[model samples]
Target chain A: MTNRHDHRLIDGRAVQARILTELRAELERERAIRPVGRLLSVSIGPSPEIEVYVRNQARGAERVGLPFERQLWPADITQEECKRRIAALNDDAEVLGIILQRPVPAHIHVRSLQSAIHPLKDVEGMNPASIGNIVYNDVALAPCTAAAAVELVRETGLNLRGLEVVMIGHSEIVGKPAAFLLMAEGATFTVCHHMTRSVAMHSRRADVVVVAVGKPHLIGPDMIKPGAAVIDIGINQVSAPDGTLRILGDVDTDRVREVAGWITPVPGGVGPVTVAMLMRNALTAHKRQVASGWLPPATLRGP
Target chain B: MTNRHDHRLIDGRAVQARILTELRAELERERAIRPVGRLLSVSIGPSPEIEVYVRNQARGAERVGLPFERQLWPADITQEECKRRIAALNDDAEVLGIILQRPVPAHIHVRSLQSAIHPLKDVEGMNPASIGNIVYNDVALAPCTAAAAVELVRETGLNLRGLEVVMIGHSEIVGKPAAFLLMAEGATFTVCHHMTRSVAMHSRRADVVVVAVGKPHLIGPDMIKPGAAVIDIGINQVSAPDGTLRILGDVDTDRVREVAGWITPVPGGVGPVTVAMLMRNALTAHKRQVASGWLPPATLRGP
Candidate 1:
């Protein structure tokens, strides 16, 4: 598949459209009983950057006919405010899946705010319970990025078991949980973080290397196994000749593609799948809460 | 320092004594305010094989003044009966730790029995809650064997971080949890189970090798790196010329000793430390229960 596999590329827009089509019917069935199937994403501040990202997801949810909205707050929002809003969204039965946008203002206590999200509404799996479930290999809602990581490889019809997979980062969102998920699948994995002394050496040995470190083009051709599969989860911004910036992946695309058998370009690869996962999360949340009262509230649907 | 360090000849007895001493004191204090702390181990039938093993552990707990007792059922104890007794123990608070002696016929519901143990009293850390905590890298209790493995290696005061440690076998009691613990401490770990293709290649590459497969002298001098640390946690029986049985570790200590810089002798090494760890688990259980106020009913309390 050419790297031109734009938005619908890896799991491209078409596959996503097909997925959304399924979710829409279930969502309408959900809204038939309840007023609406709700999905509230917590976006701190109206920075055009984060707002655009949130809007893209909102648009994706809308396209699926699943009603969704972004609860935007100031960038310098207080921990109390962030948590209160998340709790409010959680309490609202209409709000099924809760998404807390990343880079949630470094100083605003995102870690503490994460708990404010009820486990049921916690579609992103940021809460400790969700994280524990991941470690225990329990079938609960997993973190979105981790979900995306799994989808990226699995969507390609690859079996991960017994693969020497290397995850390059330890951030709870993308790296750590992904490693645990991979481990639970019986894949041999190693987690290399900032303190990892020989990350390149380690990466070079992997049959599949999944990089999530938000560093622009940190990995090159020499750091990969020949014909290895690479998924660049990181999107770093850099300036162009016109002084305008563009998003670049952690892997040096041109150089890595030579050695990598299968590579996901930054723009067209993991991005579309992640949005699909969100819509799926919302659909699942709606099914559990409004559709099937048999599904317990202590899981799945959460902020 | 000697390869002949004995399980009967080590500080395990001393540690067990200290635990009893402390438990006795605690018991007295509890007596002053509604007393009882006893432990009952249900033994299936009179299999001398299982007897000897459970007896050693029972002796350790007895030496510690745990008010230890054993209830024996026939060797052909039915699954229903075993399940009934285990459920009874879970309801009986006086029984602090329930060790359904191993070698219980394989057809029995082992997972069911394990799940029956109350989380607070699961000193062995086999309870799902404790296992969940361990997976989360939480400061909760850990399985005795795994804890002993860590304590045995950490006793050397060696920095485990950055060490290439290889663990053989994947029992929940020993290998799996030990690997997770070591990984959390930043040790690079590789696991070889029954299905592992090349044990020698993995073992030879290990800087610190933990073998607990219970195959007599399976790991030899040739399977180790020069000056590497060898921790032999396995205990297997071999026949003597007199037609007597002798317990031996998986590592060929006589020869491996010369090559290994540090090693844990079969009898003296992990076994006694395992008992000590069990005692620690009991104390840990009490502390967590008392601190959290999440203790179960009186039926689950100690005598």
Candidate 2:
């Protein structure tokens, strides 16, 4: 007799407050014509989980009106002075987006300061040329937890083409960029890592599973398939049994929400839609640096 | 009664003559200590199938000693003059490796002259930073038909960690870099494509399938699984009902080599180990441009 609150939990802070209210109405119509881009965020040493994820990304970049900053440095900086301050925020010009942050300092190589951040100001897409331009689907700044786990598997409306999904962590920042953004949405995925000999024989024939393997629960309820659409993107912490320390994910959400039909519930799922996909990848890296002329486009100033 | 040529076919010219005799003894010990790299091969027009693939990559770069030039051009060039002659053979410090050659001329932007070559002389890895450095396993130079279909699935010696695989075709040059080099050798892959709803329900539960969908037979022998390890990576051409023209792959291989225990055939499999993996990606792009000091390291001059 299943029914553990009959599944469907995926609210991710109401899908990160409806993508920060459509990125605050497209940054108030591109900041009423001009001067908008800022992101930055660096942080070299300090962790209380990187200052609670840089104060929840400066309160989701001031509730999506964008502009965030932060910087910091000295925890014995050198990694060539933190890649010369991330190559001066990749030659600033009002830095559209950057993001370094992580428990840095063990001789910081962090993928060479995430390959010295400029895949158009890598907005937390953590550049390897923005994860190899998601194999030429030409993904614009992906990886905010693999674009919030492919936006919670497109909020379960399903039909990501021939969707079979299954992912379960292969990481290079969230299971191979969430299986290259679910193979650019023609999903027929299945990555399963830690050399998956049988992650429940590919998550019980997935229709969508996701997981992101940090492992606390390591998916259960016979690795769900009943009404699939799982998504987890784990954030483990564990320790309970009265020693308290909670926060767990990689499924088993009350027995996979009593046999899944849409799950995602670790501290309200995919962590507030991965901080609203890092403020929609800082307005998609400021509309690809204003469509590659590298910024300077939104003009029309004060009427 | 399955004997349609029992199985174990994977020869690919005996793994391209054991990887061109260990890249001709590491290019005769780095060309008996000196002058060793040159691969260019550009091409723009005159295509009798790109002059039979630049005469099989200048006869596999002169039977592996290296130097293979070609360059061509005028089939109505101009994609900014083929990205200014591939950025002048990417600043030719003796061109180490380039290879643009395809059916160019449809207003040229062949991935913008393959991003103007030079992901350290690309060596046909078709750079998006060498396919996003295969998500930081930092694949020296991949995509020679996805590294000859993961070296014919490691010559089916299995044990790519948890080996399940499947792949079929997502193609960023051979199914998403052979599912990111079989998820960096810890397999359990599964890409499938053409909106895979049921590529025989994930190739009858793979143990290793691979196909690379250029779709000829599209994998058969009841979608292999009996003894798996298939690897096809399609070549396709077909016409022969005595109307000549043959070559065919995407697996049917005389009925999936009677339920594949290891298959790989269709013109001596993965087409001559994808030209000996483009001469082992031109000696792995001249040992990554001599380990990124950008050449000048192999010196040992005259005995």
Candidate 3:
């Protein structure tokens, strides 16, 4: 049971489930018109962390009625091989939505595969065309995690317009795109990272906080706004003194809940929401392809 | 005489002259390979202010031995008409580079024209494709003002790695892109606008300060690093008590020069550097078009 000290925990499991349910209906609507919705993920290694992340994302896709393929290559795969796979996905008509999961083998720089992905099927928004579309207000997709964070905050019925929101971290996947996302929603924001003078100083004055630095409990109650909303985006499992593994948020969830009016827990918060968003993007991507008369000949259902 | 305080001003005037000289040599080089580069500017309205900026930029173009044409439309011109003229220039074989002067009638939106311009001729980096190219780190041009300000700072011989930078604006045209530009160079930065907190605190700690908020004298001597370099990117002219117009920067120049080791005066600092950068972009645009082998017969050039 959740207590007052924990405030109201954001049920990411339920949120993601409900969002995927909505997506399933959209997928049916899309399929009725054209049955060519397929999703692809480009993976480089077999690390436990990367595997679990992609595994759950696949589950979410299945629930939302999209076929997912995990193209696993060796850890030491050459950059050329990775690019070849991406180009193949671009050429493959069956694959509508593509996500090249991050922490991509350090050798495989993200920028190399951007041009390889078809801009319409770029669900992960790692490509510049997708990001530019978001920034320029064109009809285009956004990076899943950043877009999910923004939509989740909005789902909480939080009014972002003209709100003093402070975002900590600036990875292309989260921070930079999220700033532009909220800016589009009329919430002026400040982005602080390792290079910033004081992260807490900016966080304390904000009405809403989105912390995605991925460090365990990096943000504590002392750094939060009184009665503010906290969304913890870190999925870190740190070993305790007793040799036990404990999942933690970028925020000290225990202390922050007492001060925050609304809070999203670590494991159940942004993590699940990201998968749901990806599934939604897949449906949208397939719909565009079908409408443009470019889908593969996989008509599973009738209109 | 320019004193030691102004010793290494990077003298925008001198830099502009040198760039034009190089542009002329490049013209000869280009003519030897292909055809001469030509420039065209589409300025809306006869606002003397817009006219002055356009004229100065053109003068910089001429100083480099490149010829140019100017098309001035009425201030009441519709967005459709402006775009039509811009499209004509874009399709014109003689026009290798197109400069669309800003402050477009206060009611017309320029975004409509952003996607239509050839990425090669987008000297301002205002086009969506150019912005996308920057985000992806592809081979593309940057906004002239941001590129110039960065060059002027590096021209002073400072290594930007891990350096503290305070940018006092958030416009895509100047401050925001400048932050990304500096960050790409490994400099840590903080972007501030009307909404930032304790801006003075951030500014004083910067090893380098770039103020582009367009407010006259927003920064004072106290808001500067001792012996720090200042590049004023503002172009504001305010009337004094005696009814005379005076140009000032976001920084208080008179007192800041005492504490600041180097400074670029408001009028001559970033302004001339921007024009020089534009010429450089124009030449580069011409080269790309020539190399692409798609130049129309009338405007065709070869590499």
**Model 2 lDDT tens row, A72-178:** 87888789877787787788778887888886878888987888888877888887877887888887788898889898889878779988888887878888877
The better candidate by lDDT, 1 or 3, is 3
Steric clash pairs (candidate 3): none
Model 3, residue A51: C-alpha shift (Å): 3.6
Q: What is the lDDT of residue A182 in candidate 3?
A: 75
Number of backbone-clashing residue pairs for each candidate, in the order shown: 26, 1, 0
TM-score of each candidate structure, all chains considered together: 0.73, 0.39, 0.74
The candidates' DockQ values read 0.17, 0.30, 0.24
Question: What's the candidate order when arranged by decreasing lDDT?
Answer: 2, 3, 1
* Candidate 3, CAPRI quality class derived from DockQ: acceptable
List model 2 lDDT by residue over B1-303, tens digit each. Answer: 223354478778778888888898888888765576688787888778778768977887788778787878789867886777678777877888888888776877788678678787888788787888787788878888888989888988888988888887787777888788877988878887787878887788888888777879877798788888888878778888889998788777877777678888777778788889988888877877777877777675566
Per model, how much of the real contact set is kept? 0.08, 0.83, 0.20
lDDT of 1 by residue, B109-214 (tens): 6655665777666777775545645655664678888887887667656787777788877665677678777767877776666654456766786778999897
